[model samples]
Target: MQAFTGSTLYAAIGGLHVGDMLVQLVFFIILLILVKKYAWGPIIGMMQKREEYVANEIEIAEQNRAEAERASKEAAEKLRQTKEDAQKIIEDAKHIGGKQEQEIIESARQEAERIKISAQEEIKTEKEKAIQALQDKVASLSVLIASKVIEKEINAEDQEKLIDEYIKEVGEER
Candidate 1:
């Protein structure tokens, strides 16, 4: 506990070198200014450029993704349209096939009917021919029997006329 006079306090604080302290403070401020102008300025500029690049890349990626989604939707719509077209075509084909089948059946039925009518006409013609031959044979037998019984010969024209008249009479009786 000695008395702290100005001279004794200065001696106790190791003689207080103000000039050296001021010189050291000025150098430290100069060092800080140099670091701010050279190193810190470049570092801040590089960080800003890197941020802008990253943002641009993100925007491009988002645009690409949206385009991909639009393309996928268009492809799906085209596929649906194609399927509808195919279904319509199949239905039309079936309808056409049914119509053709009906036409074929009708044609076949008409052909069969025509054949049946032709066969009936042929049978009628053959029957008429057989009946005509039978009438001729009967007329010949009648003429032969008449000639044998009368012992007279008749002319051809007279025999034919007689047979026609007899056939007419028989038809009228029936």
Candidate 2:
């Protein structure tokens, strides 16, 4: 019965006055609004800026990747061209060497032919001179034999008659 009496002591003990509860509720709402305005706005803005910076970095990396690929392709093409040029140069050198070898062989053949012709001409000239010398020697030997035979066998009168007969025989033979 004393506990149930309606007085300041009972009100405090029960914890149920309408005016105090309403005032506490209003203060709590004001504190929530202030925290939203002062603390949450800057944090949201900073997050947005960070997201934009990350996106820009990704784009730059993609561009650099594409440039590197292009440079690599160009280098590969240049290497192929250099190999082709080197092959062509080797082929040209081989062709030139073959042509030079042929030219050398031809020149050697021409020189051999010239030497053969000169040797043949020299042999022919030597043969002609030898034949002429042999004929002259035979004519002089025949003259000497005839003179010795006539001196051993004939008088002056017989020599005169033999000379006349020889002249007649020579004219008939001719």
Which prediction has the highest lDDT against the true structure?
1
The TM-scores of all predictions, comma-separated, are 0.64, 0.60
Flag clash pairs in model 2. Answer: none
Model 2 TM-score is: 0.60
C-alpha lDDT of candidate 1 relative to the true structure: 0.86
Top candidate by TM-score: 1
For model 1, how does the per-residue alpha-carbon lDDT over 1-174 read when each residue is reduced to its tens digit? 788998886788799867788999999999999999999999999999999999999999999999999999999999999999999999999999999999999999999999999999999998898788778867876776587547756678776776777677657744
Q: Candidate 2, residue 51: CA error in Å?
A: 2.5
* Candidate 2 lDDT tens digits, 1-174: 355556765577686767787899899889888878997788888889999999999999999999999999999999999999999999999999999999999999999999999999989988888777656655654575478566688678876776676566545644
Global lDDT for candidate 2?
0.80
lDDT of 2 at 23: 92
Superposed on all Cα atoms, the candidates' RMSDs to the truth, in angstroms, are 8.9, 10.6
Off by more than 4 A, model 2: 1-39, 140-174
